[model samples]
Target chain A: MNSMTSAVLDEGKVVLETRQLTKSFGGLVAVNSANYRFIERQAHAIIGPNGAGKSTFVNLLTGHFPPSSGEILFKGQRITDFPAHKVSRLGVGRSYQKTNVFPVFTCFENCRLAAQAQLPTSMRFLRPAAMYKEVNERADWALDLCGLKSRGDRVAGSMSYGEQRQLEIGMVLATGPEILVLDEPLAGMGKEESERMVGLLKDLARRFTLILIEHDMDAVFSIAEVLTVMVNGTVLESGPVETIRASKAVQDAYLGDGAEAY
Target chain B: MSRLPRSLSILLSVAIILLGAYPLFGDVLFPNKHAFLMQKLTGIMIMAVMAMSLDLLVGVAGLVSMGHAAFFGLGGYMLAMLSPEYSAANLWVVLPAALVVVAIASAMVGYLSIRTSGIYFIMVTLAFGQMGFYFFNDSKLAGGSDGAYIMVKPAVEILGVSLLNLGDKRTLYYVGLGALVGVYLLLRVVLASPFGRVVSAIGVNENRVRGLGFDPVAYKLLAFTIGGTIAGLAGFLAAIQYGFVNPATLSWHHSGEALVMVILGGMGTLFGPAIGAFVFELAKMGFESVTEHWLLPMGAMIIGIVLLLPKGVGGLLLQLFSGRSKMEGGQ
Candidate 1:
């Protein structure tokens, strides 16, 4: 068993790993010594209360914020200082907590732009957009996956709030990333929409490594294979869903009376 | 209504073709009046090229540059300065030289200016344009504030075989029309390509585009360079058309006029800027003929157009043809 552990460590099975990742804003430390690992093709949930630095942590991981200290490794390669575009091109895709999308563009155009980014010749200026068959195919597939295939013609700005959120996920998926870091995918979602998103997350977990940051305990617990709880810019607990559910510290701090409801 | 109509594209192509061939049979249609009209046509064509170039930056790239006229004037100044009275410059030599110089200058200016966005981008560009204006205004090397007049235009001479005469009004008119058509076709190809999509994406949301694995800065910078280069082409035509170069060409007022042309024509449409240029020039000429205080009527007309037609002439045309109030698929 010890030999197997060493071999797994040697092989670097963890797709994304952060060692002592830290971030500070003026005097306040947003993320302090955040050492985390996300394994391949697994669903990991980062759950915490408001102001718990969960969003800051995601921002650091995506290079939207420079870490105060520590290193980040993706597949054994250090990517601590990689810009968001470079990180994305390295097969790490993400969706914003806010429903951030190309509002002025059509849903199809939004996905198509994302899909085009994944292609080898995205910078080619002479070739027409219609000539890229694979890019369009990927966009179509993503739109269908997000239940937005029929609404592809509609302008994204005109879409309902729930539909816009769905389009956000569709865009991320279209980029053809190996790892998906979704920030509050279910925020402001109604019961039916949340249920639909949960199903989509579960399906996505089977194909791509997903790191979901969410506050909804029920949704997180249902879709998460591994859970990492954070509070006050530090990890409270990290383990399987059942173990986290039974933890006394988590129950007292975050779950409160909602633990029994779950 | 719902989709970009197929007939619109056909109509645009036909319109462009007719405009190009108009000068060919201009004499037959207008009789002796062709020479007088061709002069106006040449001016219209040059301004159209500049306006279209501005639209590339404003419409597609979402970069509102207020110093675009700097590039236009710089191109004209290059020809005027280089081909002084001592040595008359050849058309082949002067044109490429001006393009190269403007390309380099634009790359430098765009590199610095594009670092800031929104209103900052506008301000930075305005500063650069005024700097160019002042530089020319103070320098006696290019005839100082009064500006320099090109004694001789760039003559097309290939191995002592004269092809096109720039001295002839009709030939110059044809050349200007040809250049406009070339620039239009080139932009059409670019807008249909992947780079154009990236530019469009940046316009919508730069951060989202960055998250999708494309650097918005690079695409925006490329667009700035392209826009600048086309404006330079317009400047080259202008210098040849007027046989002069002036500081006023690089003024912020000219830049504002170009923006007005773009907005009045239609923001993102390829053909809109050209139409805007035509309307603007024609309006000025027509109004001047009618009254001494033409600015009053002209300003009112422009304001009316802006208020009544939010999408400008192009959008109105689109709505008329499609028979729909809501025009879908912007650009």
Candidate 2:
């Protein structure tokens, strides 16, 4: 019992930890008893077949939906039932799978707004916000980082799907979160777009702890340091790429026939 | 120095000069016409300012409130109540005191109402507004249902010369215009600010704003309070203009009227509400002159506008202007 307790304590060093986190929507159990840990500042990829509760897990971590039972610890602090805004303030940022953005605003304005959330007061109505040098500088920096400097003036809804995805990630990055959970960042992109996103993710992983949910095996294998495979609301396997590739359990759950091939 | 377009700026300057000269040259054109027109203009201007304040929340912030008239009525009644007791008709004292009281009242109401969104927000605001109406109606101290009448009007004692006497039609008109212009300028500054962008972003997608690290609720509540405060200012002006404050001032119908004005003019645009207020008031005046059942036609017009022009007259004007610009480019 003492040894088990110490093992749990060791896992606490990770940026995010879930102990028996579960969620049910009336008749359907969206996420079952799931114990998960993601190491600090490391690229952790959660790959799974359809209806594996991966999206549900992301929602739970980001406070989009409350968990039925369990505890979510972020950097040793329990935030299992924190509101979405509180979670964001506590260094948890997430991107929706469905490309959520302020459609009417310019890309720069969108990024600036995202960055402004960290400011002392977003409620200063009388002061001229455009003249705020720090906010302008930060917005410019975020736009440049996301490769949207030239397209900053363009409205978000008018942008191409790939650009919107990039902007979505840029929006998350502007929040300055220690933990970034991206839900299928490369959902509906072509080969080149996927590769570009993978490169961006690789760059991002160096500074921020990343939890990426992806169906794109090539992208996942290329970037992930540690991989977690979920199957039917349960984590089927979790290990390094090589171990995951060799494991028959992982093969049957996720990477079908010829397990060691990848 | 380079300036705004020649035609637009020239037109605006000419209009202002003409309006300023109207009072001076009053007796020359149709004798009593100037007084009647000025009086009508003042009422329209006050209503326009009220509508614009509501637009700040309904249009920009995407909060549909049905209790806004409570603040307006409260401000007006407070001024009416205090004016008689204190004999304070100075703009500096009465205006600020009324505004401050109304703002505090609005803040309290907004704090409670902002907890619920969508239909709940609308219903909650409506509930609070009704409460305000009942309180004023039952209060024997302020004449209860009979309402209170203001004997003194807000005036600026400028170097022994009374600049804005509410009794003087021409003076009242200028004051109303000045208030309208001030509100418009203030709104323009706010809409262009970062806070404005944040609120607009909230309107577009609140969840995104949250993920970006903003507490959308706090910003929204602040906007609600500001909107209520401005509406109260308009109410204060209205009470002084009419020399009366009654239960009708705080009614849901008044709230609906303000919303209609916003919708008729334009929701998101700065000067749209003013345009809407003028059009609505003019339409009502025309309808009343033609038939006794003016409400039927007015209601039909509002319904028609809501159905046909979802973006309002300002949006339609914007579309026309943009289209014209495109045609000019082609030429």
| Alpha carbon deviation, residue A193, candidate 1 (Å) | 1.9
Which regions of candidate 2 deviate over 4 angstroms?
A1-13, A258-262, B1-30, B155-164, B322-331
**Model 1, global lDDT:** 0.87
On residues A40-126, what C-alpha lDDT tens digit does candidate 2 reach at each position? 777899988899999999989998788999988876678898878888888888998999988777798778777776686677767
lDDT agreement with native, every candidate? 0.87, 0.82
- For candidate 1, lDDT tens digit of each residue in B1-331? 1234567778877977777777788889999877788899888989999999999999878899999999999999998987868556888888999999998888889999998999999999999999989989998879889999898877788898888888788788878888888898888788778888888778767888888898888888989999998999899889988989999999999999999998889888757878899989899889999999999998998999899989888777776666344355433
> Of the native A-B interface contacts, what share survives in model 1?
0.84
Total backbone clashes of candidate 1, pairs 3 or more residues apart or in separate chains: 0
Q: Model 2, B117-176: lDDT tens per residue?
A: 899999999999999999999978688999998887766777768655677777677878
Q: For model 2, how big is the CA root-mean-square deviation? A: 3.9
- Candidate 1 residue B198 Cα shift, in angstroms, is 0.5
* Residue A227 in candidate 2, Cα distance off native in Å: 0.9
Prediction RMSDs, each to the true structure: 3.5, 3.9
